[model samples]
Target: LKFVCLANDGIDEHMVWLIGLKNIFARQLPNMPKEYIVRLVMDRSHKSVMVIRRNQVVGGITYRPYVSQKFGEIAFCAITADEQVKGYGTRLMNHLKQHARDVDGLTHFLTYADNNAVGYFIKQDLVAVWRINGSVAMFRQQWMLRTFALRRNSQAESKNVS
Candidate 1:
């Protein structure tokens, strides 16, 4: 699998990923707009990366640079249903973080995720910055410090032990 910068030619596959995410969100929220998926795809900034497997788009992460906050917000992240638990999501996220650091001049990343996704971000070393609605909603952030250091150290330790 390789990461690809989605172009107009890949919009159909991009819509598939978008629809999958929209369906998942609608099941939880119920009143989500039917056009929400398309809108997200259209509004995505240039920083988005699509994960492609055999020329098929399977996952993606969208980010927008914030000049005022001096950070980048990970607006949308989704992996296909058949592709979950295969490390694709993590790769997509890591790629996004690298892009933010190297290209966007961002040292911090923030996101608002649902309950099911909270643990995933937390496992990535993102800290809970705030919780809303009695902890049902969460806002999380990660800095380019302990998180990256720990990840690098863990990878090194694994290699050493091997």
Candidate 2:
């Protein structure tokens, strides 16, 4: 359940993790163009959060933070075939949201989910705005904002109690 942020320093330090993420994305998202995935995942402007279990990557999410716009565009998200339906996707996304909120100060998130992933995004509280070019728009809801604050406060409280 550990989430690791693969740094894009153009160095060899995080090469293995990046490769693992790329492989997972390739395996899970077959319809997506491989060239697109490779370019964005390796792009310096994008950042990824990988789910690491027992020193192996199980899932990951790639996103580009638009700091000036106060939003982050989620480029790709996936879990390995065997790992789906185990709630890893939810955790991975929550981790990514936290990273965006804390690190980049992003207030919203945007993603273009294909039909296959529409349900997943809906479950995560994202709504479809319009259906142009088959890209479903997912936005941050006001309730999610309040819920995130409450959850964070409770976690802090539990830590204080401990």
RMSD of 1: 8.5
lDDT of each residue in 24-127, candidate 2, tens digit only: 99888776678788988999999999999887889899988889988777888899999899999988888887888888888766565555666676566543
Per-candidate TM-scores read: 0.63, 0.76
Point out where model 1 deviates above 4 Å. 5-32, 44-46, 129-162
Question: Which candidate achieves the best TM-score against the true structure?
Answer: 2
Candidate 2, run of 10 with poorest lDDT: 153-162
Model 1 gets an lDDT of 0.54
The candidate that wins on lDDT is: 2
Per model, how many backbone clashes are there?
0, 0
Residue pairs with backbone overlap in model 2: none
